[model samples]
Target chain A: MRTLVLVFHPDLEGASRANKALVRAARELPDDTVTVRDVYALYPDGVIDVAAEQRLVEAHDRIVMEFPLYWYSAPALLKEWEDKVLAFGWAYGPGGEALAGKEIAVVTTAGGPESEYVEEDGGATMREVLSPYRMMARYTHAVWKEPFVVFESMELSDEALVTTGRKYQAFLTD
Target chain B: MRTLVLVFHPDLEGASRANKALVRAARELPDDTVTVRDVYALYPDGVIDVAAEQRLVEAHDRIVMEFPLYWYSAPALLKEWEDKVLAFGWAYGPGGEALAGKEIAVVTTAGGPESEYVEEDGGATMREVLSPYRMMARYTHAVWKEPFVVFESMELSDEALVTTGRKYQAFLTD
Candidate 1:
């Protein structure tokens, strides 16, 4: 299946380490199987091109939204993209079938440890924190898959990064 | 108590009726008791003034985030504001006490009906859908109040809008 990885790091080249590693891994996937689009690079001005984004969504069989967790959610630009690209007539209202039957998943990196996300651990569970995306998938009638998350992202060693990268690539293929 | 109402409608004067009514009600509150800020109007280019926004948070006892739910979330600019204005050492990490002990409430209007938000109704529960914001309040150590939501916003009658407006004003006071 054709997989589209939509990366949403504001400064992927400069500051991000974990997300950049994942992006590299995603890029290594066979060209015919995977397509990676860095949204910030595409919309530096933050204005999303709705028609183009919709076309990309239609072309992909599986859509993976990749980003670093910010303020317990995806970056603002990603949210903007969702709000603009997934319009009423095209994504959800009557006659909206742009994203139906497509598989949707989230691939994200978090600064905190995984244990910190549990309610008993004084943090929200990953499922709770990412409910917006889940809801969006439901609204669009897209099949939701288990999200791929890498925790303690800021502290991942080089060895760990490489391992995670391979695993991310495997996720796209598997 | 000083209340800060940050409005997040892209076109506050043109597109939304419920939002306009809510903002009008907030404005009717005593000026000393409430401060109204239309975020889009202030930052037309989506370039947020972080220092000014932080000051607004610091000065308020209760923060009200009012918006029309787009794609089950606020507009992109609000997320941008959260990413930029609520910075480390100022909102959450060490020495981040600007929002600690403050009350945070959400006032939102959704195009979907309340019945559609239940798990059995082919939609997520309102609580589940808003868990991200709830987690944000938890991270910031802010007191979260039950959100004020107007479901089936597109079907709101003139009288219902007035009632919702009055209730919204009371909610701010309470």
Candidate 2:
């Protein structure tokens, strides 16, 4: 299946460790089954080309939104892309069948440890935090896949990063 | 209490009914008690003025983020504003104390009904869907009140809208 990886990092080339590694591994695949688009590079001014984004979605069988979880969500540019690209009559409401049968997934990295996300641990669970994306999948009638998350990303070792990267590549293919 | 209402609707005057009503009600309050800001109008090109937004937040004792739920989350501009304005070392991280002890609330309208937002019902719970904002509140050391949501917004009656507006004003104060 053709997978579209929509990457949303404000500084992918600078300051990103885990996500950068993941991207590199995803790109190393030779089959051309995956395509990566860095959103910040595409729209530095934050203006999204809605039709073009829709066309990309139409061309892909599975859609992956990859990002570093900033302030418990994706970066501002991805949010802008979603609001503009996913229009009323095209992505939802009447006659909105653009993403009816596609598969959707989220790949995100978080600064905090996984244990901190539990209710009693003074943090939200990953499932809770990612509910918006899950709901979006449901709304669009897209197949929702289990998310690929990297917790405690700030402290991940280089060896672990490469391991995670390989796992992420396998996830895209699976 | 001084309250700042940051309105994040793409077309507040044209496409939004519930949001417009809420804005009108919030604005009708005494100027000394409340301030209404149309964020989209302020930044038509989706470019956020970080300094200006930070100043607005600092000026208010209570901050209410008002938006129509898009993709089961806040509209893109609101997320952009949050990501940009709530920067590290300012909103969180080391020496980030700008929002400490403040109160933050989300006043949102959803197209879907309340009954639809449950795990068993194939919908995400309201609390789960909005956990990102809740987590932001936690990270910023702000008090997070229960979010004020108007589900089935499209079906709301004129009387309900007015009532919701009045309750919203009360929510701002209390």
Candidate 3:
């Protein structure tokens, strides 16, 4: 399947380790199958090109959003992209069948450990935190796939980062 | 308690009705007790003044983030405000006790009716959708108050809007 990975890190190059590594792995995939775009770098001024973004979605079979979990949500730019790019009569509502039957997924990195995101731990599960995206996919008539998350991302060793990258690449192609 | 209302509407004057009415009611209150700020109007360029926003939080005992629910979350500018303004030293993390004992609440307007937000209806409840804000309040040591939501906001009559406004004003003061 043709996959498009939209990376939405505010600082993908700086102050990021796992996300950068994930992008590098995505880039290594064959261009015919995978395309990666850094959203913040493209929209430093926060003005989105709605038509172009819609066109990208139209061309891809599976759309993957990559970002670091911030305040239990996607970065501000991703929300801006959604509010602008996914307009009414295009992504949802009547005559908004552009994303119908397509697959949508999320790949996120969190600084906290996986154990912290449990009921007994007084934290929310990654799935619960990402319910908005899943609901968005449902609203747009897209299939919501299980998310791929990398936990304890802030302190990963170089070897662990490479392993995670390989696993992410497999997840994307699977 | 001193309450600060940060309204984040992209077009407050043009495309808003209920929010505008609510702001008008808020303005009628005593200036010393209620402070209202239109976030999008203040940051048309999307470049938030982090220091100033933090100071606003510090000056108030309660903060009410007022916005129309866009894609089941706050407007992009509100997320930007949180990402930049709620910094490590001032909002959370070490030495980030500025917001401790403060109260945080959300007042959101939705185009959909209240009945649509039910599990049996294949929809997410408002409480589940708003879990992020509750968690953010928890993380920051800020008290999480029940959200005030205006349902079917797009179709409210003038009388209904005024009623909602007055009730919202009471909610703020109480």
DockQ of each: 0.70, 0.80, 0.68
**How much RMSD separates candidate 3 from the native structure?**
1.3
TM-score per candidate: 0.97, 0.95, 0.97
Docking class of 2: medium
Measured with C-alpha atoms, the lDDT of residue A7 in candidate 1 is 96
Q: In model 3, what are the clashing residue pairs, if there are any?
A: none
All candidates: TM-score of chain A: 0.97, 0.96, 0.97
Model 2 misplacement above 4 A: none
Q: B158 in model 1: Cα distance from truth in Å?
A: 0.3
lDDT of 2: 0.90
What TM-score does candidate 2 reach? 0.95
RMSD of 2: 1.6
Candidate 1, superposed: residue stretches over 4 Å from native: A121-123, B121-123
* Segments of candidate 3 deviating more than 4 angstroms: A120-122
Q: Write model 2 residue lDDT over A1-174, tens digit each, in one string.
A: 999999999899898998899889888876469988888988888878888999999999999999999888998777788888888889888999898899999999999888878986457899989989988889899999999999999999889998999899899999
Q: Model 1 misses residue B85 by how many Å?
A: 0.4
Q: For model 1, what is the C-alpha lDDT against the true structure?
A: 0.90
lDDT on C-alpha atoms for all candidate structures:
0.90, 0.90, 0.90
Residue pairs in clash, model 2 = A117-A124
The predicted structure with the larger TM-score, 1 or 2, is 1
